[model samples]
Target chain A: MIHVDGLTKYYHDLCAVDQISFAIQKGEILGLLGPNGAGKTTILRILAGFLQPTAGTIRVKDYSIDAHFLEIKKLLGYLPESAPLYHDMLVYDYLDYVANIREIDKRQKLPRIRRLADLCGINSVMHQPIGELSKGYKQRVGLAHAMMNDPEILVLDEPTSGLDPNQIVEIREIIKKIGQEKTVILSTHILSEAEATCDRIVIINRGKIVADDRTANLKQTLSDKSRIDLTLQNADFASLQQKLGTINGVDRLTPIEETDHHLRVSISCQGGVDPRAAIYRQIKSTDWILLEFHQETQTLENIFRELTKES
Target chain B: MRQVLPIFRKEFRAYFVTPIAYIVISIFLLVTGWFFFTTFFLFNQANLRNFFGLLPIIFSFVIPAITMRLIAEELNVGTYETLLTLPVTFLDVVLGKFLACWGFIAAMLIPTAAYAFTVAMLGQIDWGPVAGGYIGALLLGAAFSAVGLLASALTRNQIIAFIIGVAICFSLTLIDKMLFFLPRYLLGIFAYLGADFHFENIAKGVIDSRDVLYFVSVSFIGLYGAHLALQAKK
Candidate 1:
């Protein structure tokens, strides 16, 4: 539904977004994962029409960001980072204003606001001033503002930041529900949140795309290498390495931690190898007491860190 | 154009959501009221000429104070992003805000009509200039509001916006009065540039198209400047 090509943005002489490009399909929950100052917010801002790109074009269907921004804006609902809404207006009044601006039918305005308030779970704070609401409530209100128009595309920047675990879960659920039919593009540094909600994840670092794939595929690629942790009691590192190091696929074994009578060592193997069975048999023949034996599970969090980590 | 109404309503009502609206209106009334009555009894005049004569200078300060927050506050609070991401265009935002400031200025002028009523009750006051003065006041308010909005758009700091707005509006109001400082050759041009000069011409009850065109042109120029400043922000 959306195509971004060579999108570049510069603030004076400093480059905020380099030559970056990506395409998002309709009904796909796309998550942009990056650390601070990684141009994630800048990218989202340019997509939302809040900032003009220094170069390149973004096309939504037949409308282009340059020539038909208003039409593109009509199809987009954007919530800026931290939800900087007008604080003085009451939540109800603010939503009403947004409804009016969205040009909803006069008869359907109140019902629409009510439905959004319920979806965002901000019904209780409707009469209170937005400035007085808690951070989580304010975030819910921001979500409502973004979805007020029920636009085809929703762009949210760090939608779940600064919320409690339950609130984060609620927001994730809301995003998931919205993602069932609408296209969503949310940016965040939180790996688990992205893993939980995004169907396709794009990892960006230093204003560049480092990785882009489905959630499971990102973890599947980590299978080429694996590590096993073994805690051996009464066995010294010299003998453990001398025996485990000679295993067919074992690359290296390093002592992780040592106690008076116990030793913990991690062994790394390469090329989709499993040296655990051989190592276990070798330990069985010895008089060493085995305390624990398990292989480390690879998660998307590890891939995210490795992809976006500073050089 | 239809989208301007929502923004206009929100901006107009936001002034009352805080105490600033009441405070600005009260201060405007006190200052103008004080100056008008003090001379009202001294000259024993039944006409509202003195009240209308003092409006442009009084408005030069009060209008800025009212409009200083229009764009500056939104930029400071970062709500400008949310406002722009909507379907509205830059002209819609600028026009909505400009109209809001002008509308507030109209509300401020509403209370001063009592001054005309009292003057009429006291003596034989000519309604011709009185009506002309009000029409001119609305035009002047619109022009000044546009200037204040441009000033507000030029900066993110409300205080700086207020100061810049005051500086420009004050110059426009008093420019004709300072013609003695300029060279003799530039006197005509400077006088014609003075907002007060054009304003007084309409206040004389003539409703001259030249004077009306002057206020309308000022409004257009100021709003256009604000539009350019906003577009440059991105």
Candidate 2:
């Protein structure tokens, strides 16, 4: 578990992370979502013991970052955005080095390195120079290095940045699997990825935490106005639109497309009502074949844009 | 101490894998060997007097060239973040890198022993002076390397590290010669603090504790400055 209080990091006159406080529970997958220059990486760096906050306190597993840095570092693993790898070292060699530096016992180092390499799916690249590998392989190697010592906390900065779509999904699954047992704080700008992978989301903007809540709760809170799309055959377009507009919950109805036999309409509802039943009753009296009706819920992408834009 | 050893081992291995250690040793042997063949053989000196006397001047440039990339390259490539975030302390990282460079200098010196062997084979070489000269050269190389490491820590640019290292080493080595241009009252005191003053004393077949202490102090100061620089960043 990690606790950060009043964490403000200033580089001279510029504040990178400003007075942000958040606590992460053990075994929680916390997604730090923000656009570029949104202080996500800065917050992660301060928590990882790489940067000293100008005015704040960070505690990792009850060890103060200021007083017990070595112990705190022993409990946390940080993977920077760039993967900070030695180009000339082989994958195994680099992990071995990380294991040794993390103070894993000499006897356990090899076994741990092998286990992590297997877990991160980097076994085939173990003997190859890291610089020679592709971006996906390199990111996996970085993840392996972070997991080499099996630290209790993992702080990853944009772990899926440079990978292809398939690689991103694989890496996200790996991170989720790892998060099941360890505390994970992952920083990313991709809203969908965070929604798919994290247990809770913390949206940051301009060096401040704008929103923090469970993914489902956040979607529910913002899904007040739902839109329903309907397609019909042999429907009177103007009559259907006018009739649907008169329903109690239906706020607006607009024709999306019209053909000789088929008409597509989008209906907006007010006050979180299900307008499909009312629309169905109104169209029952008309000579129209109702083909499709589906409600559109609010997505994490829309909520992210709305929240970040408010800042 | 446990963390220091792994860092030391990795840094030592890095020098070998990156061709830095090899190039340094090869250049040192080639240049020193050339100097010996040309200066001593042509002049026909029975002792390795010229060879040992010239080592400090050679080390002034060679040691810095070897140590310029020790920490600066890590900063340049952003690996310093990885290094600092580990459980290792600042002292562990500094000592590990310092010892690695010292090890490389030692390895480079090993081949130069052949020159000592050649001189011993050719004449009645005084083992005392030869031993003294080796010690002096090793200390001088270490001091130069430490200063270079400090300069490297001040910047993330390896080229800038190399240039500053060379400049510092040149100034330290040539400071004694600059005494003639200084005010007469301060000339002796300034010369006594310069590297050449102390190195010459050690190379004269004598183990002066004061001269030994001088090299140790200089090395300590340089490494201490490097430690402070890294600590400031953290």
* Candidate 1 off by > 4 Å: A230-239, A254-265, A283-294
Off by over 4 Å in 2: A227-270, A276-296
| Model 1 error, position B86 (Å) | 0.9
Chain B TM (all candidates): 0.98, 0.96
Candidate 1 residue pairs in backbone clash: none
Best candidate, lDDT-wise? 1
- Residue A203 lDDT (model 1): 90
Each model's lDDT: 0.92, 0.86
Clashes of each: 0, 0
All candidates' TM-scores?
A: 0.95, 0.91
Q: B137-172 in candidate 2: lDDT tens per residue?
A: 889988988899998899888888888988888888
CAPRI accuracy category, model 2: medium
lDDT of 2 by residue, A1-311 (tens): 68889999898899888899989999999999998999999888878788888998998877988999888888888888868889999888888888777778878888888788778898888999988999999889988877777878998999999899999999998998999899999999999989999999999998999999998898788788677899999987778867777787788878899989899988877786677787888778888888998988768887788778953
